[model samples]
Target: MRLAIYEIREGDEPHRLAHRLLGDFRRWTELVELNRLDPPYIANDPAPYRARGLRVLGPGDRLLYPYAGAVEPVGEEDAEAETYGRDLLLQRGELALMGGTVAMVRGLENLRGALERRLRTRLGELPAHPDTYGHLLHQYVGRAGGEAELRYILLEAERVIRQDPRVAGVRLEGELLDGEHVRVLAYVEPIPPGSPFPVEVVL
Candidate 1:
């Protein structure tokens, strides 16, 4: 995947950088998570002031943003292929073995597996993937209680699921479970107008 590297100039914060680059101030969290930056974004201060939640940009501080590229046209043979995407099948977070070899998942199952993985991954945790590829649902783990928070969780879950190209759209509802875990119930509308399937993701 191609990415845009943004240099942090003097007096730049997450919101300002996001607005200047992504054109949306609301996407500041995406900036912060993409750069794996914590609060009090001090330059080189070992002891940053913790009372205020302000960000300070340092020299040579830069951010990375995923850039969209032109999609390659699919051939007739590829279009007729059965699977949306393919990968080694994972059952219960472990490789599913078949005849002493790793089994593979294809078609709708592969798509489901991919969606689940994307939803469960914490943002900035996977170095191989674009920093914005995963969900930020973990942030609400211990703080979700009120109706507004629940609604935000559901919306964020839907946003993350919809990022998958295989998923045309998604309807999500958030349920708070014991141990401060949030469960996202999703009804995924796949590309090519297939029947919507139910998926559950716990974060």
Candidate 2:
């Protein structure tokens, strides 16, 4: 890993530093984690800094850049932002699949089955909790009753994921596969506060 130094300039926030040093602000999360720096970002746009605390790189602050060939990590803020964007895209694209362009591709029988397989794998891997009376065990998961049991065991997981402000809504369901395995589906959406039809006047 090569080490380099960058002098913080006026209003040079961590994300900005990532863009300047790594050519992509999205890697800011990595940068801050690497240097153990606090993020100094505030935003009206659901900033990435929420996941990490960082301070803006004001003038006179020397920041460290660590790198391995062809890999540039963000300054520890952009990843959180990108993660939100990505989560939104995943949810939007997934929901749109019920009807939309992506549906055609996602419609393939093999692909749908593939999604089922992947979902099962992901949920099955959640670490078990000792206090849960041996709950969330990877081995016992993906079985017949496991789906219902998981809803309770993973209630906190659901709550935490739903905590994302952008996450407008979420629905969970499970299906018995081949009379054996259980495939779970989580549908998420965002519904802005409003009435379908409203009238407003302005001067």
Candidate 3:
């Protein structure tokens, strides 16, 4: 597929770009894939979004628009649709948190990182100035209140985690330390062939 550069405009979103460029809103995933967006958060005003470790093809940024018919449409059974990778998260080597050496990650190691990533990022934290989602654990972390209060907070977190397409299950474990801080332990099952076993993460 031959590719062309499409400059992002204010208030622009991937679905809009895909429809205008190819007449198929479902092809929004294609635009994101070709662009290799890290954290894959699209936005207009990207400053706050970027601060949350999200990737946005913001205003004035140029992205790839393959010639019509270059990218094949997605199918339900397609692994790309079923899992994160090309559809959700960047390939292991494409983006790194620390620095170099992440390019060679394999199997569950990659999935572990991916799960942790979604947890660390806040929802609205990664979008345009007018964010409606993304409030991470750190934002809510504080002195644990009554048992009912803690349960409610964790339930809210579980609800958010369930929203991620790749996450099939979420189990949270936490303990109040000295009544001042809560240590959150998160366990997640990412869409597989990364791993069928649950992965653990401390947030």
Displacement of residue 191 (Cα, Å) in model 1 is 0.5
> What's model 1's TM-score?
0.58
lDDT of 1 by residue, 61-162 (tens): 335554454656555434322325457999988999999999987666777888898788876676644334566776677684667778878876776675
Q: After superposition, how far is residue 189 of candidate 1 from its true place, in Å?
A: 0.4
lDDT of each: 0.63, 0.39, 0.55
What is the TM-score of candidate 3? 0.44
The candidate scoring highest on TM-score is 1
lDDT of 2 at 116: 30
**Taking the tens digit of each residue's C-alpha lDDT, what string does model 2 give over 1-203?**
44444645555666777887888999888667554444343222212332232232334334556534555675433432322222112342253344444332211222223223233333324343111111122433444565565554244223323322223355655444543344445554422221122111110
Residue range 88-116, candidate 3, lDDT tens digits: 33553255434544333434454455555
lDDT of 2: 0.39
Q: List the residue pairs that clash in candidate 3.
A: 122-134, 123-133, 123-134, 124-133, 124-134
lDDT of 2 at 157: 29
What is the C-alpha local distance difference test score of candidate 1? 0.63
Per-prediction CA RMSD (Å): 10.3, 16.7, 9.3
Model 3 regions more than 4 Å off? 1-107, 127-133, 136-140, 194-203
